[model samples]
Target chain A: MAEKKIKIIVAKPGLDGHDRGAKLLSRIFAEAGMEVVYTGLRQTPEMIVEAALQEDADVVGLSSLSGVHNYFFPKVVELLKAKKLANVLVVGGGIIPLEDIPELKKAGIAEIFGPGTSTEVIVDFIRSNVKAK
Target chain B: MFDVKELEKIKAGKKKWSEGTLAKTLSKAPEKKAKTTWSGIPVETLYTPAENAGLDYESKLGYPGEYPYTRGVQPNMFRGRFWTMRQYAGFGSAKETNARYRYLLGQGQTGLSVAFHLPTQAGYDSDHPLSMGEVGKVGAAIDHIGDMRILFDQIPLDKVTTSMTVNAAATALLGMYLSVAEEQGAKYDQLGGTIQNDVLKEIICRGQYIYPPKPTMRLTVDLIEFCQKYVPRWNSISISGYHIRESGSTAAQEMAFTIADGIAYAEACAARGIPVDSFAPRLSFFFNAFTDVLEEVAKFRAARRVWAKIMKDRFKAKDPRSMMLRYHVQTGGVTLTAQQPLNNIVRVALQTFATALGGHQSLHTNSYDEALCLPTQGAVTVALRTQQIIAEESGACVTVDPLAGSYYIEYLTDKIEAEIEDYIKKIDAMGGTLTAIEQGYIQKEIQNSAYLFQKSIDSGERAYVGVNKYTMEEPPVTDLLRVDMKVGEEKAKELKEWRAKRDNAAWKKSLDKLREVSKTDTNVMPTVIEAVKAGATVGEVCDVWRDVFGQYRPKEFIS
Candidate 1:
């Protein structure tokens, strides 16, 4: 029997129009032979979690460049928990400040990639963390 | 054919090499030179007269303001008047942005550039449910003409040239601007400025598009045709390569992709039976000035020369004005570093100098604090002062195309022109820009470049100042602008009250007419103008198009 491919959902939370990093991650993940679904920019917490659940994703990666990540990222984590997606690995990347990293991690974010983070690291991290059910 | 003993001598490092080293280096060195940047432009040890073989005074780099304007667009570029120092500044309510506008004007800013918030950009009112927590976050919030009035309260439109960084809702925004100018007693012919109404780029680089591409293209042509009649002095469309570069495209990609989109628009208008000259002269451009100082200068020069040729040869444009490429440039926001935020001021200054050297008609310097948050008052002022200092203090404005005669600059300029033409041919083969965008060809190329850039930073090949190298444990802090949460409530309340008090009958009539025009092939700008005149808000006009044209579900994916 063949191994099932790990499914992932990449989303952009809030009104951030900067999706260069997010879209690049999706392409790298797909190139690495993972199943990736990207919800384009301006995704709300509800929309992100809903898409993650619908796709049956093992990991949820959110990108926010609008500086509202502290307010928006935690909501997605909380919504995922409420919707029984607590097992899903929640990840994020953007212009997240250094001080906010720990709080975000404590809220169940698997990792955070900042501006200069490589696509390979993001792809490898998702691949390593996300396990097939 | 070459001497093998000499090549072996150079390869073994047995002798000091100079002139004869070229042939020996080619033979003995690695077959492929490792490329640092994309777009296939090689980094040489140093370029000399030999590298500039084909470049001549008369043919390659003509005098500024002449045919094949590789040097510049005007003979007196920056000597007579410096580039318009237009700072991108706006946030909070219209009242607050208006105050900032007055302050910037007082600081000697020649042009006003409006940066609307997410709600306005996406064609939603501040009161819309989707606009929660985002109202006035990125930039100023404007829902209707009432807000527009306050946004430009005391500023005279006829005197100062305004540039609105708008698309998708460009027609609606331009409609509001016209109404305001009319109220201020500024004649349409007397008004001047630019609206970045290039929707094709919205699909390529920026994702702030409201409707699908077909309807969006229709709306874009509508603005071009409408501006030709009413706002004769206004630039109907500024096809932007700025966002494309900000999205991590190379300079050549920016040049090729932008001009390809412009070509598509020109062809679109021609299809509509509008004379190409009527719209081509009003077509301006917006570009990003990156830190590759010499390469950036060369790219701008190459862009002008290439665009002039295309207008003359392909479009058969007779008027010299139609072929002139007038543009505004903004320093690349991606180049700014948040770790050592203050260092960004120096980076922006270098990039701004490159833009001025490139002969941009207008320029905007990004604030240092932008990497962390929306710019505070002091940060934006510093950015503006950067441009002012260069214009007044530096001798850069003393002559036109000061870097024009440099052997290396001319070679780089021609090289960029050739590379961009190659990409343009590839895009054209894929059925022009619209089809290429739909097929994700351009988007894929940008993503590849972005990925490689990140990989380089991660691998220590590329050294970004406070990131990857020059390690900093704690980033120095700076004050960042935080929009007051009250702004959302206040704007929502204002819109609610305005909706209740406005004349409903006339609004509906105008909206219905606008909708009817949108459904057909009729020019919708006139309908939009009438609707705006009758108090039909921007949201209402956008909603009508949203219904008729339907919303754009992005077909391309990152995968």
Candidate 2:
């Protein structure tokens, strides 16, 4: 049987209006032939988690340009766990600092892409890391 | 420029060169490299006088400061004075940001460009639950008039011009700004500055738009009218292509689409029975300057010429001041890199040179460390020094429109101007910018262009020196400036104190009056000033408007 297309929800979870990175990643996902559910600017954690469940997404990519990634990114992870969606993979990108990476990854985020990571790297990571439903 | 005899001979020579014995010698060399600006305008191997053919020098390329200002907007340009070197600075609490402003001013920064915190920009109080983890993260956090008071406490409002990058809560911020001036005993006419009251593009590119377009446009126009009536020296709206360029547009798209927004604003003001010349002179523009110096110079010249024609021919403005296109430029922020972060200095320097050559009235150079985090103090000084070096040492400011007669630059200017005008005509055919933005036409264009731009970088079609071509494994950037995490807590605590100390009854009455004014045909500025004086916070006033004019929720773009 042919493999099902990977579905992901790209979310921006704060008051930050800079959406260029989020837009770039969502388009990259679409270009890789994945099903992308883009939750545009100012989405909350509850909304992102609900959308992840509603879309039955294989991945949830959080792009935070505001320095709230330390608080907001892990909150999404916790929301997913409470919602009992253990199969979903959490990832992030943007202006997240270097020191915050370890704790975020430890909080069960699959990976984090920084500024210079190519789209091919993201595509390959999603293809290999996310397990389809 | 070229006589018919010389032109024909050159045309014949070009043809012969391409296919003749000269071609045989050139065949040994590699194929010519194709080039274009980031906006994707096609580039030729070389340009000639044939490119500027049939273009009249007197009418098309008038003298600097003349009508249809294709050369420069001012007669003497930089020789009269250097462009205001304003570096955008703000991060942390009001007290901290005040010090940063003073520091920048002491270091030769002639003006202030305030970058409010994310919650502040979104018109939320720092204590709002939604503001957690984000207060003072991007820029300064100013919740109430108290915070605004601290922000400009010592900086005399009359002496220093400020540009507030505000939109959804422009009225509230301007209210606090005016109140600050009142407390300082400064005359309204003495204050010179800009509140970036361009709401149309905020919906199209930046997602910080609060009220839907109609009311947003109302508030935008209200400020323009209010500024004209009271703050005569203030620029009401800096119609911004800077954010549009940051969001991903070809250089021409940035100019064309921004001018389209300008036309919409002018039409809206005219619809309010305000004559074009009354407010058009105070109208200003803000654009982004990128690393491509020649294209950027051409882009600026083209934009000036386009706006001159639009004001004179389209709007029938009588005053020459109304026809001039005065603008400010900021170096590209999106072009900065994380890897080998120091390379950004070179990028910023080159971009600054372009902004100067483009004859900007003002400029802000992005700090090199911005790609990593908020700029440290060290980085901001270097950024300011870049502008000073270009002005003093580079000899770029010695003359006006030095590249005016270059065949290639002239060709690019004329071509870019025509391309942008074509876009304006198309937008006009679609009814206007409002209709186009509503239909997501402009947003879709930006989205598509952004996608292609990233694809180029990914495919290595674009050479981002530190990103793809000259890749190196580097240690993580740890020396970056990070905002203290205690900012949110401290701000919330202080807000509690501010709420207790202020007279609640008067604040409530002012808010009620603000709501009443919003419902009527009254300009909201006077009421807003009263509200701030009555001790209302930015969020409280914005909440009042939100109740009156519902907050906007754009249609979901992807699923």
Interface RMSD of each: 2.2, 2.0
Candidate 1 displacement at residue B202 in angstroms: 0.5
lDDT of 1 by residue, B456-545 (tens): 776777678888788677754644567877898998888889889888998889999988888788899888888887787667888998
With a 3 Å backbone cut-off (N, CA, C), the pairs that clash in candidate 1 are: none
Total backbone clashes of candidate 2, pairs 3 or more residues apart or in separate chains: 0
Label model 2 with its docking quality class. medium
Off by over 4 Å in 2: B20-22, B556-559
**Chain A TM-score for model 2, please?**
0.96
* Candidate 2 chain B superposition, TM-score: 0.98
lDDT of 1 by residue, A29-54 (tens): 88778888988877889999999888
Highest-lDDT candidate = 2
Local error of candidate 2 at A8, Å? Answer: 0.4
DockQ (0 to 1) for model 1: 0.48
